[model samples]
Target: MLYFLKHKLVLLATPKTGSTALEQALAPLADMVLQGDPRIKHCTFQRYKWRMEKFIQIFEDEPPQTAALIRHPEDWLGSWFRFRHGSWLNGTTRSTRGLSFDQFVDGYLAEPQPAFAAVGQQARFLTHPKTGETVTHLYRYDAMSEFVAFLGQRLATTITLGRLNVSPEKELRLDPALRSRLEQRYAEDYALYDMALDKHPG
Candidate 1:
């Protein structure tokens, strides 16, 4: 997560949603940056609202506006699977190396997910911890151009996002039946992506 005290904006670093590139790009301009570890980098929106807001209040009088990025549910899951399957995790419990995408989805839906399939629900990450409320300024990762444009306008600066993962994209052929449950689990993720542009109007 990144905080621009001058702009009064708090941008969440949603996992597997191209947050790294944007965070890196904007890091120098941010007044406060929370990153370099999973617990810090992927801090949930609710956690900040309830806990970290006081920390920022010392810097600025106004509560920062919350914003985040959401990738399509299927694509997000696929990225998670592929990310852990990298060579560095060859023999680790978190490795998806030998598993099919379908198998990964099955594991994700299991009651007690395995290390490899334990990625949390996207929508749950952005919801308010106590009230269950969600933010309106969410943007779609697929529509990055529009997102960058929105940010440029809001922050009053130019934003040029570069590709972070240039490796040839792998084919993600998740089973249709398993995909239904995947969608069900991340229903709000779909809703957010669908109406992202509306939430982040020009």
Candidate 2:
């Protein structure tokens, strides 16, 4: 995550939503950058709320406005499948080496997900567990231009992003039944994405 104290902006890093690229571009301008542990690096809004409360106590200032990205649920899962299919994760429980995209989704939909398909939910990451509210600002992963323009206007800097943490190319076709199931299960994420697209149609 990147925190710009002067701008009172906290850009939450939503995994597989081009966060690495944004971090590379904006880290130089951020007052604070956290990327050491995957846990802290991908810290969700619910978790960050407590951290920010303590952080702002020193300054006696309100917490910064927050933002994050949400990708199409199926595409997000596809990225995870391809990412874990890499040789780097071979032989590990997290590896998706032998699994097809459909199998990965099946595992994900299971009550107890297999390690490879155990990626956390985008809706949950952006949501406040108690309040069921999301971030102040949200952008779609496929809509990078809108997100970049917002950053430029908010931060008053021309931001340029480079692709990072890109997964290998693969044909990830989900079964019709599985696709429907994904949309049904992740309806909140789909709604949030639609809201973002409507709010920032540019």
Question: Residues 17-129, candidate 1, lDDT per residue (tens digit)?
Answer: 78888887888889889989988999997888778888888777778888888888888888988888888889999999999999999999998999999999888898885
lDDT of each: 0.83, 0.86
Model 1's alpha-carbon lDDT is 0.83
Q: List ranges where model 1 is wrong by over 4 Å.
A: 165-168, 198-200
Per-residue CA lDDT of candidate 2, range 1-202, in tens? 8888888889999999998899989999998898868897888998888776468557746778988888988889899999999999999999998888999999999999888889999889989889987888888888888888888888999988887899999998889998899889879888877876523545
Error of 2 at 116 (Å): 0.9
Best by TM-score: 2
Query: Candidate 1: how large is its RMSD?
Result: 1.8
Consecutive 10-residue window with the lowest summed lDDT within model 1:
193-202
